[model samples]
Target: MSVKYAKRMDYIKGSAIRELLKLTEQPEIISFAGGLPAPELFPIEEMKEVCVRVLDTDGKAALQYSPTEGYMPLRKIIAERMKKSGVEISPEHILITSGSQQGLDFCGKVFLDEGDTVICESPSYLGALNAFKSYLPKFVEVEMDKDGMKMDELEKALQANPNAKFIYTIPDFQNPSGITMSVERRKKLVELAVKYNVPVVEDNPYGELRFEGERLPAIKHFDTEGMVIFLGTFSKIFSPGLRVGWVAASPEIVRKYVLVKQGADLQSNSMAQREAAAFVQMFDLDAHINKIIEVYRKRRDLMIETMEKEFPEGFTFTYPNGGLFTWVEMPEGVDAAEVLKKALEEKVAFVPGGSFYPNGGNENHCRLNYSCMPEDKIVEGITRLGKVFKKL
Candidate 1:
């Protein structure tokens, strides 16, 4: 006999991208999947030193439950880092969660109600879509060119759906697509949010990893009202394993998050928070992040060069200034999932792009990650995947 689950279970499902990533576990496969940072870049030694110090100095407090809003010291650092993106706020505006991933889920918990609409890029982060789906929100996907989400479609969606909960975006180097919204679009997005009286969720996990040009001011930087809830994480610029991330919003919204965080785990890991705070205080993360940029910039350049020379004429990919992925678009009518099947047989793997679109049907695309693999593996994997594309 099968057990009945909540009706909400009908909306929630396992991530297709994650399910596909399991296949990448094979030792022989060179995976261009999983938006993972280069593990070598993690400040493991520095963190070890920090952890030891924390244990020696304040082991009891470090191990005990902390505040729901996060460690004040860590929040202060996170708030200060916002200056790079042009936002200037205090630690009081921030609420730390286990990771930005948890922040996404809380977004659903705090704001969404079943049958409400969420506006997003035509193809957005698969993980965000999954998180929001748990609350049974319908997605209204707005089309985007290189600049960002098309304004007309977004305005249209907001106008039609009075119950649209939030406008979700990764305005910096976006996931899967690697599209950066233009400054004009960023400002216009704030204008629309103000006009429609809708909140904006600006997720910026990859903003700090800028490899070239000036980093754009985040949408939150332009907020006239407290309608934008900004999500940030140390996963990209530091280590993902630490699971430290934060949300900055108006005091009211931050309080809403704190209430949920109390129920959703009481607080983030106590020892990890203290250790991360100590590490941040003692070391210069900007200098460490520079090291990461130096390595990733080279890897990105190499991957683009290889793909330029190796891929079939019908295939094209993004030349993102920063971020772990490059979006690939195959010739019309080809399904990337099918291309993935053939590539896997040749020992290469990637996430099919169809999974990124919340409202489906862009089967001719896929995302390739260059950060996790070595220079040699990037070359080898792209070459192998190219053969599969060429055959098709």
Candidate 2:
């Protein structure tokens, strides 16, 4: 019944998380499925006032087309912010993207040709895997343990597949797994990438959300050869609705991204960019981030405590120091998707870990998000989910 479509369409599939979100939208369901921030924490009042101020001060320019590289003031703010992670880059090295997600697609577009190999953590972010697949590149998923992607496995993969475009990683509080890379491995990873002569794309959306423990400097900090590309986003710390994220790389690489961005969406939302930049200029983001940390830290604790009390044997999960997620792995034979079907019937939800892998197989794991739900809901949802696991 359909008309002809591009062959690339064959490689694409609807996002599993987005599909699950529709079923979890009911008020009765306490969903841990999305990497969504709590609406209660959004600076609604601040945003409203900022919008009015921008309109009164400079309406036309704020609403009009902006430079493809992004608003200069915002870029300056981001460049300065990078120093906290031990990275020292000028605004010239940054390319503002719609979200860090766009930085992923552009990496695929900028580096991958059809049949080229792309490497990532075994159970990497599903969104990045989905983005890379659209270009028809072969995926090489390196296995992972508690301390981020295994360097030995990664180097073997890199050595075997010398055609790899780049190594994609989320080194801090990784998606789905909620595991941070050890500082030792961080240096080793940079060394391996340099030894292999492959570029590293370090996606760090959740680095600022640490609730406890030391915040490690980004993998980009160890990059002396300029082989690392760092991606930053305001979505986690500020507001996802604004969709402001940036790419920091060599000026030459950033220029290529700027050109690709022109062919993609021309540029990100111009109005939102100004509103965000103005917000940064006027407000204290670190103070706001502290407020977020307080609430989320408590939520993370409640989820872990409840699961520890209620979950049956053969069920184990991560207790992360920061970020929104805690990963659960069932016994070897159990299928997490099947468990989710039962959890949904009880009005609870989470993302199955299998979909996070590009070449999928491990169906016994799932990822629970703590930032979107309140303390009571976190307790209740995990209790409900625990009962489902027991029955399974």
Q: Report lDDT (CA) for all predictions.
A: 0.91, 0.91
Look at candidate 1 and give me any clashing residue pairs. none
* Candidate 2: residue pairs that collide: none
Rate residue 245 of model 1 by lDDT. Answer: 92
lDDT of 2 by residue, 1-392 (tens): 96999889999999999997886568999999999998899999998988998898879988899889998889999999899988999888898999899999999999999999999987889999999899999999888888988998988999999899899999888997999999888899899989999999999999999988878999999999989999899999999989999999987788889999999999988888889988988788899999999999999989999999999999999888898899998999888888888898899999998898788789999999999988999999999998998897
Alpha-carbon TM-score of each model against the true structure: 0.98, 0.98
Tens digits of per-residue lDDT, candidate 1, 1-392, equal: 99999999987889877786787677798988888888888888898899999999999988888888888888888888898899988899999899999999999999999999999997899999999999999999999898889988899999999999999999988997999999999899999999999999999999988899998999999997999999999889888999999999999999999999999899999888888789878899889999999999999999999999889898888889888889999888999898888988999999999988888899999999989999999999988987887788
Q: Which stretch of 10 consecutive residues in model 2 shows the poorest summed lDDT?
A: 18-27
Error of 2 at 258 (Å): 0.8
